[model samples]
Target: MTGSLTIGTLAKQAAVNVETIRFYQRRRLLDEPDKPPGGIRRYTQTHARRIRFIKEAQKLGFGLDEVADLLALEDGRHCREVEEIAGHKLAVVRERMTQLSKIEKLLVVLVGRCHGNSGKVRCPLIASLESATA
Candidate 1:
């Protein structure tokens, strides 16, 4: 924890797989430390922090592309830009919630219909899905 961390240690500390770290490196989301001739590459606490930041951002519904934008605006001076990005993400989350709620309601009705059936008959859920528009 005091000295530089190897890639495996960094991955463990960052709660991500080694492949994920490489993916982030390829995406330019994380910096790839220089390799010393025959020496292994090592990461710093800063890199660990950045990985955590990326993961947290993704948990809040930001995709990698959006996470990149968030990373770019991470500097304290970009408060307004960050807000704009967050505002957009909020709108997307709200819309997804609305869609999910609608789907939940439909599933409840369809499941209830199927559950209430006492005899062997056609499934209401299948019928509904077949008749569903769009």
Candidate 2:
């Protein structure tokens, strides 16, 4: 909020770990500034906002690549294009939710079958996975 922030301050303001900020820099999601003479790299309020944006996007299930595209579209010129991307992401999310629901149901069934069983048999979860692979 004052001058540029150090990495630790930025991470604290963004409510993220320092390593997460470093990871984002390595992944090219966040910009790394040039270090001054004998000083470490400094981050700005913009960098903290960007880190928060990336975390929120990820929490919503957007992949880093998709988040990058979303970030690129934040300039207001690409509103329509951003809408299209969001729509596609929504469809993908729905499909994944459906698949996960099915898996959850199967897991519930498997747990029920395992209750009170004393035999040293193979895990139902592993068996189900193997059968699906086949």
Checking candidate 2 for backbone clashes, the offending pairs are: none
Task: Write the residue-wise lDDT of candidate 2 on 59-125 in tens digits.
Answer: 9788899888777766454667878877787787887676566668778886777789976544455
* Candidate 1 collision pairs: none
Count of steric clashes across candidates, in order: 0, 0
For model 1, how does the per-residue alpha-carbon lDDT over 1-134 read when each residue is reduced to its tens digit?
45699999999999999999999999999889999999999889999999999999788777899889777766444667778877887788887676666667778775777786786544344444444434
Please give the distance, in angstroms, between residue 35's alpha carbon in candidate 2 and its true position after superposition. Answer: 1.1
For each candidate in turn, the TM-score is 0.59, 0.57
Worst 10 residues of 2 by lDDT: 121-130
In candidate 1 the C-alpha lDDT for residue 36 amounts to 95
